[model samples]
Target chain A: MHELGIVFYIIRDVKAAAAENSVQRISAVVMNIGEVSTVVPEYLTDCWRWAADKEPLLKGSELKINMIPAVTQCQDCGQEYETVKYGKTCPHCGSGNTFLLKGNEVEIKEIEVPNN
Target chain B: MDKVRVIEIKKSVFAENEQDANALRQELKDRGVYLLNLMSAPGSGKTTTLIKTINLLKDKLRIAVMEADIDSDVDAVKIKEATGIQSIQLHTGGMCHLDAEMTRQGLDGLDLDGVDLVILENVGNLVCPAEFDTGAARNAMILSVPEGHDKPLKYPLMFSVCDVVVINKMDVAPYFDFDLEKCKEYIAMRNPNAKVIPICAKTGEGVEAFAQWLLEQVQTLKH
Candidate 1:
């Protein structure tokens, strides 16, 4: 639902970067979406296809999402576990004191431009 | 012969928004306006809680509100009728959440001349709203009793980002199976420093303490 706004942000940033690099056209934009980031990859791509094509610089550009697994570290046990599976509690020690280590990324990892 | 080249940008999609949020934070800090991004699920009594808090602190502080909704001026009207404070309704045009730029636009529409605290009642969404920073000095969320106590387990990110969690609608706790302590434990698991305040917005219970907390946060921003 909020993917369209994010898509616009991505396009803006990509356009700025493309201008800086003197790139005429971008072929694809790769995103590193985290497992728990609330950004649905399918929705993002759907929105991107609809919105990105409107921009000449991003027309026909493909949006690829790379899913990053969310991990949580338990404070008491000092062990990491899958955040999506165990949530805030540590499965290894049943400890509630835990924090996310990664997998909350909503970043653009790479941009592919047509090479001539 | 054509070749495909991939640029190793490795930049965050949220980087722009983060930068905007940080800039807005600095601007607000310079102006001595403490911004609070208030979020919650639909029907979590965010408006009621805001009204109650306004009533408690209106005399002590200059207050303003920006109500963000998909397409409704209902909340803005309600806020005006209740407190007569400066209020602006932001129509997100089908967007589920307000990013920092959108928030800055809303702030631009407001008359912040003497406003000490500006409360942004974000669109009623637990998932998307938690993901965006609205350049608020403090992030607060409301969890109603009927929403169940297991919400933190299911939506850990929302709980994790919140500075304080208000357990609203506590007046009906007798009818619901919501466990306050258990919910607090869940919140603490994700964010140990998050303060949990139990309040009934309808009855104004615990609103004074909530107001006090807000005052303290505003004071902290002053220093």
Candidate 2:
């Protein structure tokens, strides 16, 4: 549901990037999606396929997602664990005082453009 | 012959929105209007809580409400009739959440010169709403008793982003397996600074505390 909204943002950013580089058309847009970012990559791709086709710059351009694994750090015992597998509780020391270190990203990594 | 080349443009998707939200917050501060972005899951009593709080503070503050939804004026209408204050609806055009740009557009529709406090009823959803910054002076959310205390664990981003977590439906807490203390603990675990105010919006129990908290916030920010 929210993935469609995210698709619009990606398109806007991709367009801006295209304009900055004087790129007439884009080949593909690569994104860094996090495991805990709450954005389903499949839904995002589906929405991208629908919305990207409408934009002339993004028409036929693929949206590539690079999945970033979520990691959590425990303050009590200075240990890092997988966020999706262990959650808030630290598996090593069993501490609830844990925080996410990464994997909340929905970032546009790069844009592939066809050059003559 | 067309050679495929990669243009390095590493940027967070929300970076632009975050910048816009910061700028909007500063602008609102300069204009002396406190924008409160209220969010919650559907059926979490956000409208009811707003009605109760607006009625309490409307006398002290000139408030305006913006109801953001995919498509509906019902919340906007309900707010206008219940509080008898200035209220307007913002259609998100099927978007799950309102970004800073949408919020700015919504604010443009209202007369901000005389308005001291502007409360934006963000679209109902705990997930996407928390991800986007709406340029509000403060962010608050309602977590009802029926939603379970584990919501904070499930939706850490939402809990972490909210400044205030209003525990609505306290009257029905006994009927549900909701532990107020445990809920507060989970919220604290997620956000150490988040203020938790328990209230029963239906029975108007403990609403004064929530109202007073809001009043003090507006006074502190606007004054």
Candidate 3:
């Protein structure tokens, strides 16, 4: 649902960046999708295709998403691990007392474009 | 054709939005206002809670509201009619989450000079609104009893980011078999520090408690 809006912003930014760099066409857009984010990669790609095709520079550009798993740092044991299990307590320390460190991000990390 | 990089920007996607929200926080802080971003699913009694809170605390604290919705300002109009406090409606158009820039624009239309507390009723959703920080002093998420106990587990970020969790529609608990203890446990597991308060917005059962807590938060912000 919201992925469409986010994809629009990403395409706009990437296109602006490409134009600034004087790139004729963008090959691909790489994004880091946090596991915690509600965005589904499939939905994002679907929306990207629909939205990107409207722009000439992004007509054939591909949307590449790299999933980042949610990790947490345990306060008791000072350990970090990936946890897909909901209500994830630290496995090693068995502490429900852990803070999320990373993996909650949606960022365009890189854009591949042919140099004119 | 020569390729020239005008700006080699390595900026974040939400950097601009974050900046504006940060500015809003500072502005609210300077105004001695306790900004609270209230988030909840639709029909969670967010508006009812506000109506009760306004009745209890409006006389003591100067209050203002910025209401966010996808379509109508009906809620804002209702709040204004109920409380008669200055209110502004932020039409998100189609955005699920009310970001910093929208909030900043919302504040621009608000008069924060005489306000001691600012309440933002975020767009109704359990997922998207959790990501954007609206530069509020406190973020609250409301969960009504009818929405089921598994909401916190399904939408962990919303509960995790909230400083306070309001369990609204407590009067209907018996009918729905909503586990109060389990709900608290789920929220605690995700956010140990979040204060969980249960209230029946229709009966105004725990509105006093909420208003008191908000007053204390505002007082704390002053010093």
Candidate 4:
């Protein structure tokens, strides 16, 4: 349900970028999807394909996702580790006092248009 | 020609929405309106708790409710009939969450004049609603006994983002193996500052605390 909503936001931003740059058509929209962004890449592209084709400027445009690895930093031990594997508990000192360093992004990296 | 030109955006999908939410928050503050975003799973007794709390504090503060759902106005009607305050239903049009713009549109439909607090009953989902900022001054959630005490562990982001967690269905906690102490512990783990209030919305036990919390929040925000 949310994937389709996300796709709509992407299309809106892409269309705005295209219009501002005077680009006629978009070939692909690259996204930086984090491991813990809660957005599944497959669902996003599936929704993107359905929603993007409705607009003439984004017909057949591909959504390329770049997965970012999640990392967590332990405040107690001053160590960083993989968020997916260790979660809130820091592997270094077995401390639950930790915060996510990154990998929570659902960012649009760029838009690509065919060079005329 | 197979050659392409790239337009660097490097913007988060929620960036614009977050900005809008902040702007709306500023506007709400300027108008002395305290907007509370309430979220939870579908059967978490959010509406029940809300009804109880509203009745308790209605005399002290001028309040309005905006109920957001994928369809139907049942909750809105329920609130209006039960509390007799101004309540409006917002149709999300199949979206799982309500963003800042949707919240603003809902606020526009209401008569904000002389209203001190606006409570937004967000779509009942722990996942998607946690992702979007709805421009509320504060965020709260309800966790029922049947939903288990491990909800914070499962839905970490939702717990982390919430300012308060209301533990509803306390009267039935004995039958369901719902450990109130463990529930508070779990909520504390996710959010150290989140205030937890145990209540039985059915029997109207411990609802005064929630109502008091809301009253204090509205007073602080307005003053």
TM-score for all predictions?
Answer: 0.93, 0.96, 0.87, 0.98
Of 2 and 3, the candidate ahead on TM-score is 2
lDDT of 4 at B116: 96
Candidate 1 accuracy as lDDT:
0.92
Residue B72, candidate 1: Cα error in Å is 1.6
Residue-level lDDT of model 1, residues B123-210, one tens digit each, is 9988888878889999999999999999998887789899999999998987898899999998987788999999999989999889
Task: List, residue by residue over B1-223, the lDDT tens digit for candidate 3.
Answer: 4342223444456666677778889988887878899999998989989999998998899999999999888999999999999999999888788887778788889987878988999999988788778899899988999999989888888898999999999998999999999999989878889999999889999888899999999999999
Error of 4 at B134 (Å): 0.9
- Which is the leading candidate under TM-score? 4
| Tens digits of per-residue lDDT for model 4, A1-116 | 58988998888888888888999999999999999999989999999988888999989989999999999999998999999998889998999889999999999999999887
Which 10 successive residues of model 3 chain A have the least lDDT summed?
A81-90
Docking class of 3: acceptable
lDDT of model 2 at residue A101?
98
Model 3, residue pairs in steric clash: none
Candidate ranking (DockQ, best to worst): 4, 2, 1, 3
Per-residue error for A101 in candidate 2, Å, reads: 2.5
DockQ by candidate, in order = 0.75, 0.79, 0.30, 0.79
Q: Please report how far candidate 2 places residue B72 from its true position, in Å.
A: 1.6
Query: Clashing residue pairs in candidate 1, if any?
Result: none
lDDT tens per residue, model 2, A1-116: 78998899989998998899999999899999999888999999999999999999889999999999999999999999999998889999898898889998999999999887
